[model samples]
Target: MNGDWLLRGRDGRLTVYLKSDDAVLCRAELAPGGPWEPFRRIGGDLGLQQGPAAVGQGDDGYAHLVSWRQAGTGESRLVHSTHFRPLLAPLDWSPVGHPNGRGDRTGTPAVAVDDRRRAYVFVRNAGGGVSLLVQKERGGWYPWRDLKGSSIQDQLAAASRESGLVEVYAATPERILHWRQEEPGRTPTRDETADVAARPGTLRALRTSAERTTLFFTDQGGELCAWRPGGKPVPLLQAAGPGPVAAVRCEIDGHDCTVLAQRSASGRVAFAAYPTEQEQAGAWWTESGPPLPPAAEIALAVDAHGTLVAATLDPTDATLRVTRRKAEAGLALEGWREV
Candidate 1:
């Protein structure tokens, strides 16, 4: 099945990654009053791609993408695209050598870009270990460095230029690894077994402020938990209810209002807007209203100014859907053509 999406900043503009049937990563630009440009296919040498990361915008208006390709010798190659401009299809896209890490089952690689357009890749090794790799601007890739000894699940976390201290949390079958790069090029401070529990899927990070971050993951019992440093992990939602949560997302509205998207097992989407009175340390979530339109895939990201944007595929119609909502305005769901 096609996967849901998450957003990361490239330059000033946001880059959206959508898995397409053509085996190439599709990208588009979103600007007010501007048209939703056609999707550009970022190719991979292998028959299909492992997926691409929207690292950020480079020095010029070029977009930076990092992905993996399977080598003819049966090794996984971590590749980065040259600076690419929207609308102008790249004459040819290639991978950056040097900083290479062992690749897993073509899963999406975790990526973050600093202000200088340098890209960082975190991937699970062949033996299921977690490692960090870096590529400096205009410099060749650096050799892969093992960040932790424990094996990591596919889900990994990272932060970029605006994200003051980038944090990476990877879960092993029995433990979790929290790696923090206080600053680029500096050795990453390691926090081993931050939590002792198997987490479902990947680790997702949301930066609430310059110094605040919230980490989301599901425990072995299938209950969702939110973890912040200097505090304990709180149960966002328990699994003993109507059904297990299929998905979860954190969104910031105007006025710094934070909301969460929870997809229940019954195919109902829950919009939980946190109360403004509580602290960010806990899993506290207040219902916004109802579920979103049912679909097979959903992708969401909030803008720098706290605008919530989401895209989903309509199961019945087989079409792409994009939605945006301001602080006070209700959701605006439209097709790709409408965006």
Candidate 2:
């Protein structure tokens, strides 16, 4: 499971969408930090192979999700749904719709919402090129528009800002490709980032501020790496483990920080913090704390009050566990509590 499957909604609620036995299950916290509701079957029976990619709090304050479902005939389709009242009882979801047309060989879909509250879904089309579908504020989805780029070698990541710009990134075999659109209904500009061999399906992106964005991925040598828009690729750790990497932009000790978490090669989950202006220095990854139980998947996020929380699925027992670190603790194992 990809840790990016968990998202913090606009209302400050955490919602997770995962795949289990041909079904897509959704579980969300009643509030930010605890007492998660029972898992609910949102979409299923279409052969969901990958977990859903979601974005919360679009213009309508609802969560938008996209996933790729395979049929018995071996045909794949991109499906989408939205939660009407994600934070309240009687939660409702829109009907599942195939946005990429039936029988399209699309990679796992990624979603992001721009400043206008319009939701954009990115996927690799049957031709191996990137394509996008847009959903407007009034609850209508536009037709698929091809972004027209080189063949995508991995899943895509997307980030948006209040200025109505949506940026999408994908890794080719040799380098990462970036596409930027300043507003909805506008053509996007394309560019290439650092020249490094990126592992498939490991690319992730986060918008740290109005003027800064960060990209994280594992390189061909299994080392965790990061790259900014115009900076060179920097290796953060040597030979990190094989799991999804997650990052969140938050405040730590009254300073802006980007917390990165991933499983180490020894099966322990560890995290490090990179303060502002130190991300590209290549020597700033804080000391990793004690290991947790071997995790099949991990998710990381920051609460409304600047608390760092982590959730991991224990591979041994197949149980989900959560831990949190307060700001004053500075990412130490002693400050982490299993909640």
| TM-score top scorer | 2
The C-alpha stretches of model 1 lying farther than 4 A from their native spots are: 1-15, 27-34, 43-47, 50-63, 82-92, 97-108, 161-164, 239-254, 275-295, 303-306, 314-318, 326-339
Clashes of each: 7, 0
lDDT of each: 0.52, 0.67
Could you give candidate 1's per-residue lDDT for residues 142-236 as a string of tens digits?
67776655556666666532543456667778766777777657646685455657454535565555665566567777766667666677666
Off by over 4 Å in 2: 1-3, 43-61, 70-72, 84-86, 89-101, 280-295, 314-318, 333-339
In model 1, the Cα lDDT at residue 59 comes to 30
- Write one digit per residue (lDDT tens) for candidate 2, span 314-338: 5344456666774355665434443
Alpha-carbon shift of residue 31 in model 1 (angstroms):
4.3
Compute the lDDT of residue 194 as modeled in candidate 2. Answer: 72
